[model samples]
Structures are given as C-alpha cells and as structure tokens.
Target: MSRLTELLSRIKAKDPKIGNELAKEIKVLSARRQFGLNFERHKPENVELANREVRRGDKIRVLPQRGSTKNSDKRLWQVKDTFKKKNDHLATIELLGHDVAETQVVKVEDLIVVAEFQDSIYPGLISTGKVEKGKDKPYNTVINGENYHALKALTFTHKGKIDAIYIDPPYNTGAKDWKYNNDYVESDDHYRHSKWLAFMERRLVFAKKLLNPSCSVLIVTIDEKEINRLGLLLEQSFPEAQIQMISSVINPKGTGRALFSRTDEYIYYVFIGSAKVPDKVGKGEEKEVRWRYLRRTDDESARGTKKGGPAQFYPIYVNKNTHKIEVIGEPLKPEDDISKIKNINGCVAVFPIREKDEHHMNWGLTKPSLEKALSKGFVRVSRKEDSQIQPYVFSYLTAPNIKKIDNGILYKKGQREDGSWIVVDPSGKSSRPTTNWNEKSHEAGAYGTSLLKALIGKRKFPFPKSLYAVEDALRIVVGENKEAKVLDFFSGSGTTAHAVMRLNRQDNGERQCISITNNEVSADEQKALIKKGFRAGDPEWEKWGICDYITKPRIEAAITGVTPQGKPIEGEYKFNDEFPISDGFNENAEFFTLSYHTPLAVNHNLAFKQIAPLLWMKAGSRGKRIQELPERGWEVADSYALLVDLDKSSEFIKPVKASKSITMVFIVTNDDRRFQAIVRQLPESVEPVRLYESYLKNFQFTIE
Candidate 1:
C-alpha cells in the first residue's frame, strides 16, 4: 500500500477524533508554507587545537573574564607602551655595542600587543543574615539575568543542592507583558511559540541539572493549552522522569456566564527520580480520643432483677472517700410465696437462690477491679435465707477519654447535651486523628481556614493558597528535618514566606524560604496616581513613571515590612540587590562605567566597572602648541598628518620645520556666527580642525 493509504487506514482504525484534528492541522500547515515551523539545536563552540592533536599547556579559553574600567583605559595604554618600549630598548642597547656608523635603528618585529584574557573576576558573596562563631548559614541569593543565563550560572555550582523548585514563568498570552532581550515581544509575532520555547528550553535544561536526584519541581499553569507540549518537552529533557498533575479548586462561585465557571488551576509535578511523601503527625494528637463510650442501661437492669422485690430496689452504696461506688455481697433470696415482684421504673425479673449455698458465691465485683475492691476492705459474701436470696447490683458511670473522641459524628450540631460538649470521658486517655476532615473542629486548628484569611489579607493575590494547605504539603516533603529549604519562584504576595514564618513560630522549626516575585505594581497604585492629579511625562512628576510606580514600590513593600499601601507590619525582611559576574576574570576588573557616547568596545568593558571616569579634552584649552605649517608645504591638504621621530636621524631629514602642537576648539552656541567667521578667516597654512561631535553638542553648537 502507498504511504498515504497506510496512514489513512491506521488513522481510521485507531482514533477518529485525533485523526480528524491531525488532518485539519496538516491542511492548515500546507496552506501556510511559510509558517516558519522548524527545529534547531544549539551547541557550544569547542576549543580547537593545532592538527587536532592535544599538547601540553594548550589551555582552552571557554569564557573570558570581565575587566574593571576604574583605571582600565589608563592601564591599557601603559601596558601597550611598556611591552613595545622594552623590546625597543633591548634592541637599541644591542645596536649601541656594534661598531656600525648607522645614525638610526629600528626593530622590524617589535609591536605592542594586548593580552587576550586581561580581566578581573567580581568577588561578591550574597548573605541572607549575620554569621557568627564559625557557623555558616545558607543565604537566599537572588540572581538577575536572562532566564537561560541565570540558570546556567546556578547550575554550574548548585547542582545537587536544591531539594524542591517551583516556577511560574511567562504564560505567553501575546500581551506586551513578556520581554525577550530587553524588549517586549507582542502576541502576534510570527515566531512567538519558538521564542518562548527556546527561552524555556535553555533554562529548563540547566534547571534540571541543578536539581538533586530526589528533588521535585512544581510548575503552576492553567488549562491544557501547553500541557501536552510541556509534557513532550519534559519527556525529551528528562526521559527517566515522571509527570503528574495536581488540580486545585480555586473558585467555587460562578460568574453566572454562558459557560462553566473557570474555578480550577493545575500544578505539574515533575520528579527527577523516585519521589516519596514525607511523614507527618498532625498537631493536637495528644488530646485526640481513640474510642467513645455508651450508657450500660441493659446491664443495670439485669443486675436489679436478682432482687426479691424489684431490680431497681437494690441499693447502690457510694464510697465518700474515693467517690467510687461500693459493691456489697449478694442480697437475700425471697421465698416463693413472698416473691410478689413489683415493676418499677428501674425494675426487672428476680432470681431465686438457696440460703445454704451462700459460701459458694458466683457474683464478682461490678464497678471496681477485683484487686482494688479487695484492698478497699471488700470480701465476697452471699446473703442466705431459708427459701431464696437476691443478689445486690451496683451502678456506675463508665466514661472514656474526652480527647480521644473521633471528629466524625461529634462535629455535627447537637451530638451531645448542652452541659456536655463531649460524650466520652476525659480520664487521662488521649485521642488519635480521624480520616474525616472538619474545618471547625479542635483537631483542625493547626490547618484551619483562619490561616488562609491571615495570609491573603486585603491584598487579593488571586487564588491565594491557604496557609494550612501549604503547611500540609511541606510536612509531607520535609519529614523530620525542620530546616528544609523551600523555594517558591512564583511567590504571589509572599504567602509562602508568611506560611513559613507562621510554621516556624508555632513548631519552633528553623525552616528557611526563598521566594521570587516580579515587581508588578498592584492596581491600587495606578488608581492612587490618577487620583493624585498626576499626568504622564510631566517633568515635575516624570520620575513617577509607570516603571517606577510598579517594580520599585512593590519590592520596597516586600523588603520594608510594609503593605502595598505603605502600612507598617511586623516581620520585615532586609533585601539587597545581588549582582552576579562571569567567573573568568580576576576581582579588580569586573566593573566598568556605561555610556552611549563611548565606543561600543569601551561600553562593553564599562558594564564590568560602573563608575570608571572618562577623560575628555575641551576644545581651545591651553596646552603645548605647534607652529603653523604652510598649506602649500602639506602633501595632503584636506587631511592633516604629523610624524614624530624621537631619534632625529640624519638619514631621514624633514622637508618642513617640525614642532610639537595640539589643537582644540569649543563651540559656545549652535548659532555662533562669530565662531564660524573666525574659522573661515583662519590662515590656509593652519591644519583643518578635527572637532569631537560630543564636545560640539555639549556646547550647543549649530551649523550657521
């Protein structure tokens, strides 16, 4: 059969729905030949060796170090001159020893060379808190870079250190909210998917390398829009890993729309290797009840039956000292003619017994243990009569431990009487937790609904997770180690951090949290700015721009222990910016000054040294002067040139008089007709001035 026919037959036999979908997609793809669907692989450049043969001292320069601009430009010239002059001096000294009558000498091969790798490494360590007495505490460090770059650096050293990772990356919804290479990529872009895919693929590859063998990653996402695609990505990236889905019901109240309410979000659980749930014992375990108690009305009535008159007629004696009921010997048996039983409220049938069988007693202690009754001066004895005797029965209330009561039935209204909150007794026995979950029960206090309210507060981070929910999840993963490092890169409003703080305070566990959040400003700030009568691009209020209103304020709020509105709150954290540098240079040459007017080469170096100074000579400054050369004497009139020969050789005599001179000019204003006239009137013998554009612009010069 043909390939098309075979494919059609297989599609018809397997899945009609998927086959139809694939057919439609194929048709669409055929119509759009230039849809730009393609696959590409990225490989790092390899260090090449001569003749493909390895040799000693053949070091590969994978990544070059960044140098500082503090004194970099000054040192650059110094280094070039030093190496070149040293070679010249050595050749000159050697030439002087010779008996040759040559007036001047030159070394053909001597030239200044710049070292390929002449830069410094940035040596900055980020610390989360204070250290003391030889103890090293792990600090939460923030890395700022493009996704792949940051991931690569982190993976280089942090492999096998992370226990859990949570990421909430860009959703790629086509809005200008997402940025790639410092510019926002619009939704309608042709290669949107490819761009996002490439971005995520690089980071995910490195992120996988950073995870420990048993570590897990939880990715929060919405719908199945990218689920299948992400699943395929994960399969290719981590072939041995397994992917599971956890759905959380976020919204229950519908918007009363035409379709079903969008209430749930999914979390993709990706485990690097074998994943195990941590063991956790819920709180208030000591107060929980194991079993319940029921009244013994049937046993009470049976014991009363042995009495001659009525079962309820038996008298139960109470011990005043111990508050325990005292059990006496068997009661006297009634005669057959005198056994006229009366049915009372607590009465039952009577038992007949012979008086001579008093020594052979069958009744045992009812309320107390056998040993306890004996120790309390009780003996087994039977009352005797000529006809029959009735046995005495004692009544006692058997209660169970109140703490051990199950939360199932007791959670309902009116389970117990008004005076009794619990049906079971409270005699020292504790209870175990039940499978039934009660939101309002005492056992639920550790993970109560109240915790959810505290975390979210007034700032509604949509679908904010309940604190109890997170704590319960952590308990399963943390096990007995109270110092587990938890990371939540998608931390919205710092809920996870709050939960960690609360858990530590309650359990005294020293759990640490690393939370990351984009500095998106809240809605309230936009409203407040409009209300404050601010307009866009107003010079007086230009600093209050959109970017400033958003990222800066939100981060400040998080670090300063203040609400989005700047209200003070307890438990503030000190935050500092962490700048990471490439690991290829020495410490001194990693920072440089940045500017637009400077050459791109200089600016690239400036990124390493942010505060390096720039040296500029203003035009018309007083300095060394050169005598005017005749215009007719110049070989090139339009272009100016000068040569300096320090040896003053007789073999190379200059045709014109040479003098050391430096030219400079400064424009006072753009429309300075006087300066233009002066330039035109300059003698033809003078060299044409080479003015710096920046200096001219700085003086506000205009061509007249």
Candidate 2:
C-alpha cells in the first residue's frame, strides 16, 4: 500500500481520541521549536497565556523612588525568594531603581516583550506612498511579520473594535506551498493537515478576540482541498455565529483534472452577534429571477406591505377569453374593504397574487405599478405548469425568467374562452444576485491577475485574490458605517487592501485595513537561494519572502499609484469604467516589520520612544504629533496624548483636558503603582491606555 494510504489506515484503526493525542504531541514540539520556552526563570512566561513566549526586555523603565506608592509591581521585581528561582524574573542593571542589585528581582508581570519596528526597514510611511487622508479617517496599515503575534498585539489596541475579519489562509495542499515553523509541509507529509490546523487554531483564538463580537462578520475563502475542514473549524470556533456558505465561480472554464474540472471556490460567512448577511440588489431586470425571490412570495417587504405602499394596493384587470391583463384599476386605500374593491373594466380584478385563487389583499402594486411594469415589459399573463386554471399576472424585479418555474406564467398562452385575460412581453426581467454565483468580474484573469500585474509588474504571487470579490463581500457587511476597520490576517498579495482603497475612493468612505503577513523564507528554500549567492537574513533573502518582497511592495504600489518598478501606471479601470483609468490608487498606507527588543532586562525609557508608531496607528494615525515632548513627560494631540513622566504629568493633563478632542492618553511607566496613580490623576474626558506590557504578554514568540 502507498505510504499515505498506510498512514491513513493506521490512523483510522486507532481510536480518534488516541490519534488526537498524537497530534497534540507534534503540536507541543512544533510550538517549542517555533518559539523557545523561557527557561531563565522556570515560572513560565506564557504558561497562563495562549501562543506567547516572552515579551520585550527593553521597555523596562527604572522607577526612581520619590515616595512609597501603593502599586510597586512587586510581582515584577523583588528580593530573591529562597523558595523560588531567582533567575526566573530579574531586570537588567540599567533598570535597577535601587543601588543594591543583590535583592532586586524583576517582577514576572513587569518583564514585557515590546515590538520595536526596524527603523532601517520601515522608517515610517513612505513619502510618495501616502494615500490621500480625509478628516478623521484612519490610515491603512500593512504589517510584514508573523501574523500570530501581530494578531495578539492587536488584541491590546483593537480588541472588540473590528467590524470585519477576512482571511484566506494557506490551503495546506501537499505541494510544499506553505511553511510551519520555518519548514515547508510538503504534500508527502502525513501530518500536513494537523500542522496547518494547529497553526490556524491558535491564531484564530487571538483573531476572535480582535473582532467586535456583538456586530461583526467573519469571512473566509477556500477551495475544495480544505473547504469542508475549514467550514467545520469555523462552526466549532464560532458556535454563536450564524454560518453560511457561498459557491463563487472563479474559473468559468473549469480547471481540467483527473476527476473533473474545478470551476468554483467557496466563501464561508460566519455572522456573529447582531451581524447579518444583507440582500444584494442586482441590475434592475424584471424577467431573470435566478437568485432573487419572485412571485411576491413573502408577505413581508411586499408591495402593499401595511403602510409601505398604500397607493400601490390597486387591482389589474384580467380578460377571460384572451387571458390578457388589458387594463389596470386604481389602488384601494388601506381603509378600503378588499371584498368591496372591483375592476371598473368589467373584468376580474387581479391584485398581486397572494394566497391561492389570486389572494387580492397582497398585490404588490396599483394602477401606476401595472402601467410602469407593463412599460418596462415586466408584467406577464400565464397559468401554472400542467394546470388548466385561469391565467394570472406576473411582475418581476429584473428580467424575464431564464428557466421554468412550477408556478410560472405558462409558456403556451393557450386558446382561452371569450373574455379571457392575456398579456405578454419579452419574458425577461433580472433582479439581484443569489447564492449560486456566475459573474465575469470574479474571473481571476479578468481582474485579479491583470490588475495586480499592472500594479506590481509581474505575477509576484500566484492565483491572487480578485479585488472586486473581496470588496463585494466587505461592502455587504459595512451597511452604513463606511469607515469600518477591516482585518485581513492572510492578506496574500494585498488584494484586500486594494479593494478597501477602491471602495473608499468610490464612496469617499474612511475605512481602514490592517493586513498582517509573515515575511519568512522556509529553511528548505534558503539552501536553494544560497546557491544563487544569497544568505538568509540578507536583503536578497527577504526578496524571496512573500510579505516583504511581494505584499508590502504591492501595497506601496497600489496606494502610491505606481508600478513595482516605480513607474506610473496608466490602464483601464478593472471594475468601474466610469472611473478614470489611472495609475495606482491615491490612498496612503504604512508598512511595518515585526521585530522585538529582548534586552537582558527592561528599558522603560527606550520603550516609550519605540511605542510612538504603534500609538500613532491606534489613534488612526491622527496628527504627526499631539504634544511634542522636548525631553520627557508627554505630547498631546487632537486624538491622543503620550504621557511618560510624573513631573510633567500635569503639563500633559492640562492641554489634553482643554482640547476636548483627545479621547485617549498612552501612559508609559513600568511601575504598576505609578501607572495606577497616573490613571487616577487623568481627567475623565480622556481614557488612559497602557502599551507594550499587556500586549507583550500575548505575543512574545519570535519568528525564526
């Protein structure tokens, strides 16, 4: 038997519970190898946290004793307890507040992992790559790093604030396409699925935290390879969410394969809390009822709904001999009796067919409705299939029917007795989209590839996502909130970012997108690159990674309206023809690489400086600087202020209070006692936000 078959059989032969344990063993080892366990002090840095190891060692600030405070963060540093390991928690010599270092041991809670951006790589937003900023709109952010830690960090600033989470994770196809810990999980591997699941599960747990559980949509796209598995995972992970599946046609010409040609992919919609899947309005064609609800089937939202359309409650006259609706009557008032209403044309009054025998009470329109529908060629006269009943009136929202409906207007408007009602126009009216999708814009080559190539030059990433597809999915969830915050953890070639930019440009919305991707080259591929005279950790090696060389550059190009070669682009608009064909979108974006500062001990002062970029991002990249701190203390801005020193805390507080525009102040202090003290002293108008320490506890893992 084949090795895979044998492995499958062996696994199936064992109890699923036992096999599950086996998978856990691999997971534990994977976690240990991917992120080293903190052994200096065996108290376990992330023992209580999920998917975290140790945080930044540099953000530790030494506390100078003015007087004794209530919250000294004794948990971070203290006299070495003979009963406990001394090495487990200890700050660097620079962080020592006391002259004597023998008794000082840093508190476990105080040793945080701070994410310091590589200044040489990021250096802040690119001058020319800035998307045009409108008042109060947040800037888009693209993070080039491991998404797991990125998501954990987001839980600090964006927890419970995100409106949508769209992800297209690795498909885990055995083609060595994706990596786990630095090693690619090739197709021949027996545990490929297990590793991918472990990778996804931990990140998803953190992602769930970033979402606004009360009103948010979780959208996931995948193909046949792992669609079923992903669906089950989403269901299990988000049990409270309403799960829905959509089959989207990506390839009109099926991908010819051994079994069959695969023509479609799927999108899973997990509507959490008050979130909903809205109705999609299509081009106004009356005859084509492919996906839309026709026949005025549901009494709700129908034409004559209660007080919805009082004037559209009239009857359409039907002739018996010809089965034609030759005349339409005036609508009756809501107060008029249905039994008393009659057709003035000496024909049967046909209200929008409601219940059997043409329930007249629920007709969708009045005389004007009939006249308009007739003019638009929407009304039809026919009987149900295989029936000898009298013909009825049919009105469609779109084009005429493409296929036969059991209760449809009969194709054969057969011979009728004298005075029969009859009416017919070209029977085609179109409405909105349905679950079964067939659209050309969704075609990858039409928009996905051609558009991405125009922005990035060559096909940097294979089978990139279509911009229209992502935008359409996002548009439905935003409802009225145009400036929604969107998170795309697996933002392949930055299609989601491109889509957000296009949407903002079209509607002048202020939506912001946070894209996180790992810029890691697999170990197996490093050997190959080395033969090409390049080594890992070098600029050339980074070019092989997706996040840095492809995703970030693509984002820059898309936002700056330039090609990857830095040339201005001029082409036809892919989705909208009315919009001018232009170079890249004029949207602004910032790129950041994930790097952590792991000092021997904490450096609170240095951390204060490093956290400015993060603060800028959290405040929607408000102004360049709110209050400029000449040396220490805080700087104030319209959206937020940064406070560090107790001496100038009052200086920070005064202007912040008078501004009336600032909503948050980032308090930078290692001592919990001081942190609480500052919180107590801050004005009620502004909320105190702590950085690095809390977030470090969640994302301490390093990407090797």
Candidate 3:
C-alpha cells in the first residue's frame, strides 16, 4: 500500500468517523501522487507557538494580525502575567476593556494571534483603498501597497463601511481552474470542497466587519449542487444575517424525449439583519363583478321600438296639437347612435327607467342617489309646450354601460402578428406585476436562463447570469434607490458591472460597482481575450495577469458600456491597484514598525526632541526668535524654552533664580520605561505637560 493509504488506514483505526470522512481525500491525494501532478501545500514553518500549544481545559481567544512587513522582524509581544498561558500554544489576553478568547494558528501561512477571554469577538479588518468620490472619476482610487488578502488589516479602517458584497469564487470542481498553493487542483481531488470552504471562510470573517448594519450579500450559485452546502456555510459565517432564496428561472431546457424539460437556476440572498427581506407584491383571485358608466345618450327618445327590434318600452311625449312622441335632447353622434334599443336580446340588452314616485327600483343605485344624479345633470327631462293635461313631460334614466372584459387574465404572452413579442406597459391601461410568478406570461425573453450564453456567441463561461435577470432582481431589491453601491467578486465577462451600468442608464441612477476576481484564466478565456486583441507583454495587457483575467479591452468595454457585439451604452470604467502597507515602507522597517505618525500641532515641551532642531532651524532662518518659558511655570534645565519674558534674555537659557536657569524641552521616546522615567523626574512644581505620540501608534492604542 502507498504511504497515503497507510496513513488513512491508521486514522481509520483510531476514529472510524474521521477516517470515513477523510477517505475521499486520501484517495485523491494518492492518485495525484501516482500521476506526478504538482500540488503545493503551505504549512507554517514556525509552528505558531501561540496557537498549537493550547493547554487542556483552557479557553483562549484568537486575534489574527495580517500584512506585517517582511523586514520588521517584530516578534509578537505578550505581557507576562496580565494574560495566563493556557497551553503551550494559547494565551488569554485582555482586549477592548474585557478579556476575550484568541487563537494563534498559522492557517495557510497567515499570521494569527490567539487570546482567551469570556466573550466571543471576531477580530476582522477592512480593506484600505481609495474610495471613489464623484462623477468626475468613473472608478475608485486605490492606494498603492494595500494588501487584498489581508482582511485583519482592514478592520479598524473599514468597519461598518461596505454597503454590499458580491463575490464569484472558484467553483473548486478540481478542473485545473483553482489552486491549492500556486498549483492547480485537478479533477478527482478529494479536498476540493474543503479548500474552497476554507478560502471563503477566511474572507467572509473579514467581510462581516465591512458591512453596515443594513448591508446585504448576494451570492450567485447554480443548481441544487452546492447551494444547500453554501447556505449552511453562510449560516455559520454570518449568524446574525438572514438568508433568503431568489430562484431565477433563467433557462428552461427541453431535453427528454419522455420527460418534461428542465428550466431554472437559484440565487442565494443573504442579508445582515431585520433590514433585509425579499421584495413581494400582492396576489389573489377576483371575487366580484361591477359596472361603470362610459357615456350618456340623448333623453328625447328611446329608439328601436319598431316591430323588427327586440321588445322595449319608450316613454311617449304627448303634444297638445298632436299628442305625438318626440326625442328630447340633441341627436346622438353617428357612432353613438345605436340602430336599435332592445330588451333581453341575445346580443344586446337594455333596462327601463322608472320615476321616483313609481316605487319600483330596476338598478342598483338608491332613489336618493338617482335624484342626486338628476340634480347633477346625469339624468335628463323633456317637456312639450302644447301638451294637454299633466303637462306632457318625460324623464329618462341612463344605462350603467357594461363592457365585456377579461376576468383575472392579467398577464399575456406570445408574439403578435408582427415578429416582436408583446409587452405589458404597467402604466398603459394594463395590469401590474403580481406575486404569483406562474401567472406572469412574459418570459423576460430567451435570456431568462441562469447561464447566459456569452454575448460574443459561444460559451466562454460555464455560468454567466443574464444582464436583464440581474437588473430585474436589482430593480426588486434596490428599487428607485439608484445610487447604491454594488460589489461582485466573481465577475465573469463582467456581467454584473454591465448590468449596473445598463440599469443606471435606464433609470438615470448614479449606482456604482466594485468587482473582485482572480486572474486564473481558463481555456475558454484565452480565446475570448485573443478575440479582443489582447497580446502578451502589452502595458494594457498586464491587467489580465491575475487569476481573474483583466485586460485593457475588458476595461475599455466597461468604460464604453459596450457588449461583445459592440453596441454602445453610457458607462465609465477605470483601473486601480490594491497593496499592503509593507509595499510603501522599505524592507527593513516593513515588519518592525507597528504604526506611523504625521505631525499635527506640536507643543515645545511635547514634540519630539530630534524634530525640534529641524523646527528651530526653520524658525531661526526666518529671523524669528524662539520664545522663552512663562513665569510661574515649572521648566526643564538647559533646554530652549518659549519664554514670555523676552526682555530677560537673548541666550538659550534664562535665569529664574540665579544659578537655577530654566529651559523648555520637547521629549520624544518610544520606550514605555523611558517615557515613564521622564514623567517621574519632572519637578512637582511643574505644571502637567502635553505629549504627542506617533499618530499611527496613537490610533492603535486602547485607553483601557
């Protein structure tokens, strides 16, 4: 048996569950070993004494520190008794005015510090890059030397800052598309999911700190394959967030000669808190039918009273001279004039009008309501001058015009006589969107498939979401709030960015997007870039050097807002670089320097002594004299002081009481012991002094 097989057998003998769980891993590793494929595994050389030595029954805390400079050589410092050593690998440290648990382990060669305390507090950081400001620039300004992988470095700087996060990481199917160290994980690898999970877990821990209370994360996934597992993982990572499912039926496939075609993909929507919920609209069935009036005809006569017309009654008007019936109001328009008025006909029907005194009601309206209608000119009355007894007069009540309309058939589909499909205009005398998705007849076009076919035609990516679908989803989530920021780390063909730009143009919004992707290019990718004129060694070409390809053409496409087909839209794109602080400092100072300070206001007695001479040089060259110490204040001996008593001396020293000359001194020290010693030596008579430490160190200091 191979060495790996033997190791697995031993593990199985000890713990059957662990052995069974890790069996697949052993087989894959063994296969790779036999095939001579290169797979790199990074292990910490130093054993991370703080994490590996946890003592039995000891509870410890883990705080991770990242992006330290290589040359700093600064060892992790620990205060002896303040924190008890729980184990050879663990220590309980006090932080944030409380004792907390910290773990010190080297996960993938990254530095972590573990402390033990009572409460659970995850130490994560934010990414310190230049944030985009206004319309003048299309992209954010990324400060040089910011490490992209070091999440802990960003916590203090980026806490509660991110509005949204979208990431598309490697699928880790072991198709030579992902790396274990610098090498790829080929197909049949057993630890594929484990590696992917670890990668995501580290980033997610940091990502949590970056979110605002109302922030949300959108993770795009395919099929039932890993979505459930991913959901579980997310639950573990962000216990405070609520998980929502948004299943987009992007592509319905018609496959079986015997079975129904398959269509649809799912998107997982996870939100931070109560602030997140899926957008929904009301849905129900119609229960009642009602009629509304359209127009009124003349009250002069009720037509269609002839023999051929359906049986109907017409109120007759008596003439004093002839006692004949006549139409009252002006004749109806040609279109409105009906050939005949009928009662109970198969095709048309009419109802008779009754007087208030008649006591019989034929319509739904009340007698008082009808009277009010007559008062408002809705009903009409006619009178004849020559009419005999009872003053020949006629009153006619209008019909409650009925029109046959579709009942609950709100949505429609299919193309019209013309080749184009029919679209329901929400405001154009049509129904609004309803919650019953099955009722929606509109397909949103053939592009509804979750795996959007590449715009350039062939499939360059395994699963690219349709731009329209993303926009639709965004419309439901963001609605009219157009200025929201969007992030998508797994930016394949840059569809999310494209969708954001398109949505912005359509709505005239100022929405911005940030996309993070690896430079690992696949076989399909190289062909795509080659078509775009990307060549090796070009300045514009280096953008594509990372695991996620970034070429000049890709960026140009984003800026011009064009698809692979070359259609122009309104958008802007720019490039930026993220680096770590170590990149800014020289090698010697990179690791050792914990913080830096920029000069703000400097008091003579509190400023760095070494810097004082530089300030003095600048002040003296300008012909201004340094002031002397004030009266009634304690002073340092032999140091130049800013004095209020200018008349007493031109010398650096001033006589306070003969032989006891007083001067002002600015002391600068980084050593805690030295700083304390200087403070104790100051005379009791001296007033309290103001001291300014390095701004970087000051920022890192916790009062407690």
Best by TM-score: 2
lDDT of 2: 0.60
- What tens digits encode model 1's per-residue C-alpha lDDT throughout 357-475? 22112222232333343342222222212223333222111222212234332221222211123232223222432222222111122222332222223433333454444554454
Full-model lDDT for every candidate: 0.34, 0.60, 0.37
Ranking by TM-score: 2, 3, 1
lDDT of 1 at 491: 51
Q: Which stretches of candidate 1 lie over 4 Å from their true place?
A: 1-147, 175-177, 185-187, 214-220, 254-259, 278-473, 490-492, 517-704
TM-score of 2: 0.60
Residue 114, model 3, lDDT: 28
Candidate 3 residue-wise lDDT, 460-515, digit = tens: 45455555566655555555656565655555455566556556654566665544
TM-score of model number 1: 0.37
Candidates in order, TM-scores: namely: 0.37, 0.60, 0.39
Better of 1 and 3 by TM-score: 3
Model 3 misplaced regions, further than 4 Å:
1-158, 254-262, 278-462, 523-555, 558-704
Give the runs in model 2 whose Cα sits over 4 Å from its true position.
Answer: 1-136, 282-433, 521-528, 581-586, 599-603, 625-632, 670-683, 691-704
